[model samples]
Target chain A: MCLKSVEGIVLVVGDNVDTDAIVPGRYLTLTDTRELGKHALEGLDPSIPGKLKERNLIVAGRNFGCGSSREHAVLALLGAGVKAVVAESFARIFYRNAINRGLLVVEAPGVSQKVSDGDRLVIDLESGVVVLASGETLPFKPIAREVLEIIEAGGLIERLRKELQYGRG
Target chain B: MVNVAMDSLTAKILARASGRDRVEVGETVVATVDKVMIHDVTGPITLDLIDNLNARIPKPESLYIFLDHYSPSPSIPASGIHRRFRIFARTNGVINFFDVGEGVCHQVMVEGIVKPGEVVVGADSHTTTYGALAAFSTGIGSSEAAYAILTGRLWFKVPEPLYVRLDGALPSYASGKDIILSVLGILGQEGANYKALEFAGPGLRTLSMSDRLTVANMSVECGAKNAIFPLDEVTLDYVREFNTPIDLSSLSYLRTAKVESPHLTLDLSTLEPMVAKPHSPANVAPVPSVEGVSIDAAFIGSCTNGRYEDLLAAARILKGRRVSKDVRLIVTPASKRVLMRALQDGLIKMLLDAGAVVTPPSCGACFGGHLGVVGDDEVIISSSNRNFVGRMGSPKAKIYLASPVTVAASALEGCVTDPRRYLG
Candidate 1:
């Protein structure tokens, strides 16, 4: 359950990448996360899904996942095997969705400008530092203990089962 | 000791919901959820999660399910999704299940179910639309929605509100759409990220219920957690129409709560019609600045506009005019209630005479769901919120966000035109 280090090649995108750009409303009918993955980021660029083949991490500028409350956006990213997302910031709803889906999203200011596509990144979830291929280190705010626990438990489903079992006493 | 006095309206609502004396900004609280709404788009997925966890709804009566997105089931898969919602509603003993043609979820929720000071969470993002009624409502993802249904609680980090002061009466041509688009221009898309927009001022008395709803609905375009309008006489009057006995004095305490300093002030008198150009809601310019940008289609619908008042305004401009041959003018009401009222009032007939095609009440084309989707490289003027890439149809298509009146006026000229000229 320990999320100590996640290493992957990074996918770099610019500012204001919204949920609609992540997955359009037209594709929302598909309930399968794997089916959704094929269309991931297709709204932004038709070739984005192809680029996710080798990259497991994304570095984005400010206000990523800015529109819509659809969990499909998180499902799509996860279905595409996106291990983590490092953005300058996230819209509140998308952040909550990623956490509930057990997707690792880090808010690292200046990371988008510092990283390039295909660069390897080793993110230390416990230490809140992102190690770059250039041997540089960028720090990010650590995820809250409660939220990290939910992620470690695989998602909100497990947490809810425990809460329901304990009867909220 | 916490400073319990001088709490903002959002702080007060969160405190009450969480059963705390006071909650500070940045502090997380597990607040009791007052109302929950799920639509066809998210309902099926949420039910799946429920089944996976073997969870039963703690309070089925508090949850409302709507089948408005793919109301008639445009495709087989969509039909299956609607069927799943129906089965789930029946199995859970949910009484507030709204079937197809119920209009949009937000509009129906505002019609009666939402009350001031309650915390409402919906599966759709525009749940912020309820804040026009002074509710602390916001949107959430399906998984979290499932959790809320199972536990009747949701967690929220108290947000520091950006206070806005509005003064002066709106011009004849300008409506809430312009006012909100103007706000988005100043705040940009990310300016209000993770913060609440608390609106209050002398001008609160000037706006109608419909106008306030439009403003609150689009607050999310600027990435606000929620946009709330304090309870006022206008809202009270609207709620009273539905015969909901609401105490005016009991809610007056919220009006007295101390709000922070004004973050942005807008004079409705000086405000002109505004439009958000394609690719972003923050890419806004005045109607005059973008005038003469030819359009292939014009739409008046979605949760943003499409109210009865919105249609009446557009009908006034379109009563004698015919839609330009170059444009396809489509009008979809926000809900069946709105559509029925428009039909009974002759607004629908007037729109038809003007060559506008009126469709049933659905989300329709605003999110590119169905009907009136544009072609590649085409341009459209929409009364709906969000002009993000590929929002209406093709990613290459340009969408302009504007008032219903502007969409109507643009339908006549087949280009982006100001509503002011037609108002007279």
Candidate 2:
């Protein structure tokens, strides 16, 4: 099931946020992910990881996640406690990984300018609404009903488990 | 509003299309895997996962593994990965594994493996490069890649294919790299997000297989799932040279898969040498349009521009000259086979004699992981794809993406300049 949490807002960047930017090639050997998280966005803003520790929502422009299909990008974001990513568009691979891992990624093409850094955001996945502390409400198209169900059921693996259990029991 | 019929190739690739008209912004789709490709960098990991999952290797003949990235490198870990991949393929009875020195995976697969109407998936993003052959291919992660290797199937939401039409013959100095960058300038980085870019028009026929591959390889730069050019006789001739034994009598299968698109044309006769300025891949302009831009490093290679044709082009320019003293030029062949062929033709000696260092075939400077690191405030005009900030090295350094001719010319001048001046 999706969790509704209000984490602080973290504005990293927009437009071609490549995998190399999220987790540089040097850190590829370290599989622990926590260490990889430290370098997330170090290519752009060196202070992102520490700032991310206190933030929840990441706002960005078009093509929020592009480049390599490394899942480490998603893991690093989730590990840093980002509750949702609001972008105008996302790379296909990144979009899929976020859902499979139960990370909330909302599509708000207008969200980039509506919110700024240090702003508080309240995301309600169930309602597909993102509300800024300034009381600005950004309505995003929710994931397909069935996809939401899979995510609500705890991602693909858990959904598969439930399906198997239901079949046998 | 407009009626368009899906072509036979598209129909074959989209047989599993759920008939949904439009994929919403945040929806997840389980797309059919058209083609699955792997290379040395991540194939070993995928092979291990396939063993653990105990999944049947579906269509071993269709699955491809190419050893590119770390060919001839003394890196023990890289060699270990290659060895394990070979053992896995041999033990599993998988048929399509191109060993080191074969060629870059994208080029090898396009030249020998891919066909029209196929949906290809690779562990590398440039897999989209195959779209040039009128096939649909995209990159996937190692885990999801492992799943595909095991099950021979993966899910994808059918992406709405963007229609880009180029109609006129390209000028001699301008090449496919310029066409793609020009397209990127119009589409922007995110303009084609999650969409397949289908390139068609009379002008496409004028471009060679290598040229089309260069265009398709960088489609990912604009956030496209893939960029496709309908397969034709040019593609067949190129593939036949490599895979002589394959019964291509069934080539007619491609015709039946053709998707009908309205004619859209781009006249390239007046196009000039173009460059994608640093910090972003889509930021583009004519090379001569930006004058006096000095370069510290110049690289010529990658799956995109590391083909034999690209090397020959550079060799022609470097034959009787030397790279500028302030500039260090690095030439990497996309594959060991390319290296050997270049050596046989004395392209290697020509490049070295011209003051360029020839390195083994690998991702190398393109990914900024190793080799050809640039210093702060330095700028490089490279034949490889993508010029994003720090793509080749230090974030402080800058990269400009250009054609091999431009890179060669810039290497001689030590600044971004037109290649045509040196040609005459």
Residue B211 displacement (Å), model 1: 0.8
Encode model 1's per-residue lDDT on B1-424: one tens digit a residue: 7655567778889998999888899898999999899998877779888998887787999999999888667889998888888888898899999998888999889888898888999998899998898889899999988988888998898998899999888887889998999999999998999899988887778899999999999999998999898887787888987666666666775665334468898999999899999889999999999999999999999999989999999999999889999999999999989999999999999999999998988987899889788889999999999899998889989999999999999999999998888877
C-alpha displacement of B128 in model 2, angstroms? 1.0
List TM-scores for all candidates, in order.
0.98, 0.89
Residue B264, candidate 2: C-alpha displacement in angstroms:
5.8
In TM-score terms, candidate 2 sits at 0.89
Q: Best-fitting candidate, measured by lDDT? A: 1
Best of the candidates, DockQ: 1
Q: In model 1, what lDDT does residue B78 have?
A: 92
Model 2 ranges with Cα > 4 A deviation: A2-9, A149-153, A156-169, B1-12, B16-34, B40-62, B70-102, B244-253, B256-264
